[model samples]
Target: MTAGEDISVRRKKLRYRAWHRGTREMDLVLGPFADAHVESYDHAALDRLEALMSEEDPPLLKWVMGQETPPDNVDLAFLELVIADHHARLAK
Candidate 1:
């Protein structure tokens, strides 16, 4: 219904696993929250995520691969939550 919700739905439709073989690739493409678990995301959420991830060091690629955790940033946490929700929905 919302922009975030829309992104999540689209992500679910994508062949995420195929596109991202493991956490390494996921992190590079999706960022730290790549492994967080997204269930219902929308465009706005993704845009926010991109903005947040882009500003991080190691390119968030390392984080998604379990190499590290993002700094304590409110925006990052919020994006992670959205990504996690979308991942959950895709699992179903």
Candidate 2:
């Protein structure tokens, strides 16, 4: 992000990107997580998430949904949080 970008502006853009990942499933997997966390995410966690976002959707979605095991580099802890948050949203 540019130095001029406000934190809220940056967070809004990140949320949009998360919701607009190339497929609907990916959008649902990540969009709400970004909405809930981006504003509060520290740079390191946000960087890790951004790196994960660059990964292909199929494998990443599978990892999030627990269909396929993620490689060691994938952040399972964070993915679990996303999954839990998604489930909670669904339960509401």
* The candidate that achieves the highest TM-score relative to the unseen native structure: 2
Instruction: In angstroms, give how far residue 12 of model 1 lies from its true place.
Output: 17
How many residue-pair clashes does candidate 1 contain?
A: 21
Residue 82 in model 2: lDDT: 77
TM-score, candidate 2, is 0.82
- How far residue 9's Cα lies from its native spot in candidate 2, in Å, is 4.3
Put down candidate 2 lDDT per residue, 22-51, tens digits, no spaces. 999999878988988898876777776787
Per lDDT, the best of the predicted structures is 2
**lDDT, residue 56, model 2:** 92
| Reference-based TM-score of each model | 0.34, 0.82
Over all chains combined, what TM-score does candidate 1 have? Answer: 0.34
Q: Model 2 clash pairs?
A: none
- The 10-residue segment of model 2 with minimum total lDDT is 1-10
